[model samples]
Target: MATADTSETVAHNPPCTRRGSKDLPPDLRIVLLGSSVSENSGVGNFILGRAAFDSEAPPDVVERVGGRLKDRHVTIINSPQLLQTNISDHQITQTVRECVYLSDPGPHVIVLLLKHDQCSTEYQECVEKVLLSFSERVLQHAIVITTQEPTGTNDILQKIIQKCANRHFSLQRSSSPDDLLQMFDNIVQMNDRHHLDCEGLQNFSMTQQPTEIFSEGVKLNLVVCGSDGTLKSAISEQILQQTDRRSDMELHGRQISLVELPALTRLSEEEMMCQTLRCVSRCHPGVHVFLLIIPDAPLTVEDKAEVEKIHRIFSLSINKHILILIMQNSEHQTAELNKQTQSVIESFGGRHLFFGTKTQVSTLMENIEQMLEENGEGFFSTETFWEAHMKKLEEMLKKFHSLQTDIQSQGNLPKGQ
Candidate 1:
C-alpha cells in the first residue's frame, strides 16, 4: 500500500500553525494593572515604539487602544489606580472585564506596574489586592514590571523582584526593543500553549487558613527595625550569627530567613514603612515576625518617639508579630538600659529580652515561636489593613506638623502667652 497520500495528510495536518488552527486574535491584548500610570504609559509607548497610550489624567472605567509594535499588532489597556481611588472592587473587575472584550477576545498578558521610587505599604497592598483579585489561572499570564532604571549592578534586586511575581521585567533593564519583543514572544508562546482567555477571565483570591501560615515551612521573615543612628545592623549581624563569609546581613539558618532592615528613621520613613510592609507581603507572604531593635545606650527622646512610630505603623496584628530586642553594650550596661527601657517593653506587652551579646537571640526566637503558636496568623485583609496603616501614618504626620507649628508659634508669642 503506497503511503496514503502524503501531500493530503500534510495539507490536512499543517503542523498546527496559527493559520492552520482556530482563528487568531486580531492582535495581542495586554492589560496594564496596578499603579504607576505614567511609567506604564511610557512602557506601553516604548513597547509599541511610539507614543500610543496617553498617560495623562487617568479616567475612571477603562481605556483600550491598539498600536503596532514591531511587526505585530498590539492592544494596550491602561487601568486606573483601584485601591487609591473611590472605585469599588466590583467596578474595577468590571473595567478589567471591559478590557477582555475591547480586544475582541481577551488579554493574553497582564502587566502589573510597581514603581520602585514609590513602593510603600499602600502601594504594595494595592498591588497585592489587584493581583490577588484575579484567579490563579490569570496569574500564570501575569508579569510584574518595575519602574526602577536597572543598571548592571542591580542583578540581585532584579532577582528579588522577579521572585515576588514569578515573572518580572524592567523597561530599563532590556537594552533595546528587541529584548521586549522576545519577552512578548515568550508570553505569546506560553499563552498559546495554555490556550488561555477563551472566555472572560475572573478575578479573586481565596482566603487561606490562618493555621496554614506557620505550616508554610522554614521561610522565617524577621524584620530587624530600629531608630535612625542606632545599631540595628550590628545587632542583627550578631543575632543572625552572620559570619565573615556571610556578611550580607541575611541569616540562612535551617529554620530562619532573617533580614536586617535599616533604621525606620531613615530619610523616608514613608519609604521605609512601605519597604518593611512590602518585604512582608512579598518575601514573607505567610507569617511575619518583627524584631524591634533598641540600642543599649540611654533611650533618647528620639528613640522613644521612633519606637512609638514603628508601633503605630505596624499596628495590624502587631501584638502577635512584634518582639522587643534590647541590645546592650556590655553585661553591666544591660542593667541601665533595662530599667530605662521598661516603658518600651511594657508598651510592647512586656515581652522583652536583653541581649548583652549577639548569640543571645535564642530566648527571643522562642518567644516569637510562642507568639506564632498563640496567634496562628489571623486573617489579613491586604487593602483594608494597609489603607488603615496609611491613615495612621498621615494622622501621625499631621500631629507632628501641628506640634511643630505650636512650638514655633509659642516662641513667637511675646512673654509666653
Candidate 2:
C-alpha cells in the first residue's frame, strides 16, 4: 500500500530517518492561500528549494508537496488566488479542506499571502472573505505573508502588518532560500505561543473523516480524457496494463496511477462535468498531466467549436498541466490527420503524443515523465481552475445555444438560398 502511514503523518516520526530529539523539530504542515495580493509569493518553489510550481506560476488549489526544512518533515499546500477568483465561498472552503486533509491530522500553519502593490478596498475585503472560511481562532494559527520581503522594516510594511493585526510577515521575490526557512520558523514559534498543536486542530474539526474520492488518493493519476470516448477508453486501458506491472521498464522511477474519466464531450451535462472535474482535483493533490485525446480524423466545424468551448470552461492556468493527445483510430488515417490535426496539436507545443501501441504509449509516458521532472522531485500536477467553472459553464451553454439567436438576427446565411 502506498498510503502515507501513521509515521508519515506524525511530525516527529519519519520513515528511514534517524529517530531522536537530537535538535530535531516537529513535522510542519502548512497551507498557502494565494491572492492577487501575493501573485509572487513563490511558496511552492521556496519550500522545495527549487522550482516546483508549473512554469513557476502560482497555483489555484492546494498543490501539496513534501520537503525537509531544519530537519523536520514539511508538507506545503498552495491554493489559487481567492480574492481574484470568482469561485463561491463554499468552494473556497472545499479547497481549504482539501489542503487540511492533504496535510492530514491538520496543518500547523495557514499562510495567507498578501500583495500590497496597490492597496484598495477590494483587497481588504479579500482578507476578510478569506478569514470567513476559518474559525475566529484561525488567526492564532495564521500569518499574513506580504509578497514584498522586508530589507529593513519600513512604515509601508509596518502599516500593512498593523492592518492585518500585527500577525504579518514579509517575503521578497529576491529573498534568499534561507529567508523562507526563517519565515517558517516564525510561523512555528507563533503557533507555539498560542499553544496550538495537532490536538487543537482536532478540536477545530477541520480534518473530518474524508470523502471517498478517487479510491484513496493515489500518488499520480494521468487523467486521459477528451471528446472521443472510444479512443480515450482504449488509451487508458493500455496505459494501466503496463502501469501495475512489476517490470521496472513499465513503471520506472515513480509509481504511476491511471484514472479513466468519462469523455469530456460536448453533450456532457453541467452537473456531470463539474463533478468529474471536482473528483480529479480533490482525489489527487500531486502534480498531474491532462491528456486531452482528440481524434486523429479531421475535426468537423462543429467538432472544432466544441473543443474550443471545452477549453474555455476552465481558466487559462489549466494549459500548464495539459498535453494534447492526438489519437489515430488506425494507421490508415495518418495522412489526413497530419494535414489537419498537425496545426491544432502544434499549439500545445512539445507537450503531446501520437497515441498507439506500447512504443507510442511509451513515448507518451516519456512526455509525462519530462513534465514531472520539470516539476522538480514532486509528482506531475495540474493547476486547479474548477472553482469558477460555474460561470464558465454558463458562458459555454450560452455560446453553444445562442449561436441560433445570432443567426436569426442576421436573418439567413448568404447565397445558401
lDDT of each: 0.55, 0.53
In candidate 2, how many Å is residue 377 off? 41
Top candidate by TM-score: 2
Query: TM-score for all predictions?
Result: 0.39, 0.41
Task: Write model 2 residue lDDT over 1-417, tens digit each, in one string.
Answer: 011111111111112323343433467677777653134245556556655454333233345667775566777766755555455443444455555556666666777765555345655565666655655556666666655533453554345455444665444434454544454555455455232334332223211111122233334556655655456656765565544443554333443434434434433365345535554664356436767777766776754654565566545545666787776655544434455566666544446666655344556656766765664424332244544565667988999789979888678767765
List where candidate 1 sits over 4 angstroms from the true fold. Answer: 1-218, 228-230, 242-254, 269-273, 331-340, 377-384, 390-417
Q: For candidate 1, lDDT tens digit of each residue in 210-321? A: 2223553435556666774236655654653433234222333234444444345543454555545544553335435677877766788778877877676667456566
- Which 10 residues in a row give candidate 2 its minimum summed lDDT? 1-10
Q: After superposition, how far is residue 54 of candidate 1 from its true place, in Å?
A: 28
- Judge candidate 2 against the unseen true structure and give its global Cα lDDT, from 0 to 1: 0.53
Best by lDDT: 1
